[model samples]
Target: MESTTALDPATALEPATALESATALEPATALESATAPESTRTTESSTRATVHRPAGPVAPTDAAAVALRPLAGRAVRLDPDGFLGRWQRRNATETLPHCVTNLERDGALDNLRHAARGERQRFSGKWFADSDVYKTLEAAAWWLGHADDGRLTELLDEVADVLAAAQREDGYLNSWFQLMDPEHRWMNLAVGHELYCAGHLLQAAVAAIRGGVGPRLVEVATRLADLLVDRFGGDGRLGICGHPEIETALVEFFRCTGNRAYLELAAGMVELRGRGWLAEHSVDTGLGGSSFGAAYYLDHMPVREAGAATGHAVRQLYLEAGVVDVAVETGDRSLLAASERIWEDLFATKTYLTGAHGSRHRDESIGDRYELPPDRAYAETCAAIASFQWNWRLLLATGRARYADELERVLYNAIAASTAVDGRHFFYSNPLQLRVDHDGTEEDAARRQAWYKCACCPPNLARLLASLDAYLASSGPDGIQLHLYSAATIATWIGDSPVELRVDTEYPWRGRIAVAVASTAAAGSWELALRVPGWCDRTPTVTVNDEPMDAEASDGYLRLRRAWREGDTVVLDLPMPARLVTPHPHLDAVRGSVAITRGPLVYCLEQVDLPDGVRLDDLRVDPAAAPIPVAIAGLLDVPVGVVAHGFVEPDGEQALYDTRERPPHARRPIDVLTIPYFRWANREPGAMRVWLPTA
Candidate 1:
């Protein structure tokens, strides 16, 4: 259906209920990895029992603590392979390089040049700061080992060299620090991303180190963490990060290296957030709102409670990430529930037809209902990525299909369409409509420009595409449930045993998937759960190894308890058809209108698709008419396009409704393809709508 609309957890133990979704949480990752032979391990991918992979590492209460950084570092994690392909270098390189390089050409790099010479000012994007140094190096480090091309590694090293050159004697490094607060170094934990950025760098270093290369960045992060611990202790001057992302990041670091001091340091930061001791007094320096958003990103709530999704998108994502720690680690389902409740409300209210969000650029706050103004929508590329990551984690916690469903929506519609397929350009606001040059001024330009001078999107996408290793985790005490199916293989330790899985399928298009489980143990007690997309037929004939089976189905998963060897196959049919879907009657804009859709794909009519001056709500599809499916080039791929000339009923001969001059109406074909309501402006900035009247 055309209007087929798009699509977190925590610790404080706020309520008894958690969020509802498509997947259910499997038993916790209790399998110790010490029982396997040197060649194999107690992989979480055991075919012996049904199993699920939780989002990230499970540690609650102190999840927001600074320790999670190292912990995530040491552990091998997964991200859906096709899930984040939107950020791939091949997909986004063209647009992003121009954005970052602009600063190099402009005097913006002069600011970095000044920082190189001991000067700094209001900086927008992170470049060669102490915090970014480790991360940039770590990224380059990974490229050094994994990438086929050596040039990328060199560029990363060059950036790292610049960052290392800008460091201060006591180990404090922030471009803003050098210019604005050299004397105030390490004074404010809550506001200073000095530590938070450092945490990312630490993570990058760890990723690089574990990949079997890049030790320099690792040492740099360790030293920086040491300095942070020294400065933020009970006796030290600061306690929290003004931005909050660093605390969770740091804790991940601690988990990886087993550094107790970092763990204690991370706790102090988290505690400071709850106590509000870091912001002792608000700074009036234009960044207060951003800081408040930042604080929430830390999930400062000691007790989890449900509320609306408000504030800036990035900050809110940070908050949800922190709270997820509280939920999984502490076993406080309520804290997780609170996160889920808020997220559900947010999704229901704020999400756009394209699964894009971030409406207001002024405060970067979530905007009003039905308030998806095309030109001004501020759905940042990073925001879409954040939403997917958070939801993916929740999918791990609850094992809900809704999480995966929403994740799929964002990945395909919002995230995928953010940048051009070439990986070079980007649109900060991925509105349904596209205007030629609406991005004016620094603020407006931030939305319109192919890339911002800040230039975080390119590297972000680059890194994500390069190391897409961890998303497909499997095996549990029971059996296995597939959360995401992209053609990829994962090799890692699951439960004190080494297991491998090769997932083969052209999913979202076809339902049948064959999974190759490489483990010594015979698969048993494990119930294989596969998601049947809601947009597809509710019931499918699920067969295991060509035998029809009675499956346990709910939300979207078709479950089958089976016994298996290495090569196992599960198959089903996902019907793709054209249908008209109507919105809730209460939705005033689309009260009488219906949307066109095929399978999970939502279709709309652009001016390019339709020939005449046709209004969006003026046309409709006959419920009984089968839309002619056509293959047309879309923003991302060759999508299945539908063609219809007119409504089911015939037109009149310029006569009044009851004038007795009209003949019986005849059904007309919908020859005009409706563009998505959001894709209205591809041809010069104008108007586009998704709703159409009845045939």
Candidate 2:
């Protein structure tokens, strides 16, 4: 890939004319002058009363706060011998490097350099271009943590140097506003995304610090955060970002540095939302009219008053994540309750069968209740990522298996579906059904692209896949809860006693999992909880030390409490049977259509698997007939394929409208091969559908 320095600065720096109004405003002050002295700022001990860290990936060891469970961190290692291990290896080896190359190729690096040079010119990409760089850095940090790659370490240092140099004296770090129009920094709060960029930067810093790389990035992020605290609060500016990602990022920063000021700032941002700030300051700033109005940016109501998931999907998910973070850290029941309500609303109405969120492609917003359209669905990949983030936080707060289930669904189906097998190309929008005549322009591309102009999903996917280990399990008072089964080993502390467990399984491909108690401190008995996925039709058969044990499941976990000696083993068998799933009656587009799902994988039929002259659109599955199993190698990244009995609707009179019923369709036993939904569109960009019409 070409270097960002190769780009001509003069040609790339053409300033957007809309920013001309910014010249009249006052310039920002220096960081030292803007921020309060260290002595005056609240210390970690002093602020612990108002806000305490909750147990989860954000605050892994803060057990003082009231949380249902505690999350495991980098201590849980994948065995590097299973399905997810293969993907993780690919992510570290291919995806992370590809993202770095894309960042340079797309001018993200140049934007920072140009801004640091005080060049008032055109920005490289969108107003949120800085976020892509931060996400890539985060992915690199996670990859480097697992693998000792000198190349990634060098890249991180190089990027951190550019970011540190680009930082303003007063800690303002948005390249777009800095290089383009510094005066208009916080004026366009509705769509400016300054804080959104800062949020990603903060997250990158946290990841880098935790991964033991790029301490300079941490300094840059903390400076920017301090600047934010000094500017946007009671004594400072009384407004929040148009986007809602910074709150969660700040909370993580506090967890990393033990600085309570960051936590308070995050909580304040959460509380400041839904106060009609955006609605009151609505102005036509050439970013298009807020057709959905303030609600589009989630400013219609306060975070505590919001009911349903609405507006932009990614924005709503990110905002809810912040809400969950603040609620958990501050022990705010109302905020958590509000988040629960939104979760219920989303699953009840807007969510798709493939665990995808959002409904409308035109506005990138979630439509009304029960308004999910398969063909026109706009399930953005970033929305899935945000959902995963929110649900993971929720799981930690409440210790709910449903939340973990939702996270697993989003991870396996939606998140996995967005990226190609090769890990280079990605899908920005994942629609349920693709037609032959569907235009590939815009977000509805038939196949994944190397990179999108928006370019959010690629790096987001990278970071998630790189940090997959953190989401696997969590430790509770009773024992360790294995949420997602895979070939891995979990090393965590159970009440100050070190415990190590080795789990071996084929997982989604096979339901048999064997977990062995490798080692533990000599002490009392600890309960081991294995999640029995809600998708299983029957109870999971579990055995302890080769003895059949009947344990009642509570909150989706089958607990086994016993004194464990080294080498003790537990085996769980969850029946993996392919089943046909149907949509609700109100979903008129796919009411009678059935989707195939086995284990956690949602299956779809593709045209590439059909015989020659067989049209995918004309096919109908026989609901009563069983789908024959066929071992097909390299068909949509799966080891097995299902040959379903279906019929191709014979061509009839091509008429726009017919008063009488159309001619009877000829019944032919056509073989329709099905593959996992995530693996679709990798081949010829042909027609595909998750829901098939029943014969």
The most accurate candidate by lDDT is 2
**Which segments of model 2 are wrong by more than 4 Å?**
1-57, 60-72, 282-289
Query: What is candidate 2's lDDT per residue for 1-695, written digit by digit as tens?
Result: 01112112233222222212221111111111112122222354321111122122465325324445544335666766567877888888788889889889889888998876777785788878999999988988877767788998898888888887888898889998888777777777788888899999988877776665787877788788888878884635667777789888988777676677777888877777777877676454545456677778888888787888899999999988888877877777888899999999998888998889888887789989888888888999999999999888898888888998998888889988998988898899999899967877757889899998998989998888888877888777668888887777676667767677778776776677888877778489888989888898677788889899995688799988888888899988886667878788988878888888878988888888777888887788988886654445545557655557778885577577768777786778776778888998888879999999987
Give candidate 2's whole-model lDDT.
Answer: 0.77
**Candidate 2: residue 627 lDDT (0-100):** 61
**Tens digit of per-residue lDDT, candidate 1, span 136-232:** 3444544344334455455555555555566566655567667666666555444556666776676675565444454444555666666777776
Candidates' lDDT values, in order? 0.51, 0.77
TM-score, every prediction: 0.73, 0.90
For candidate 1, give the lDDT of residue 277.
56
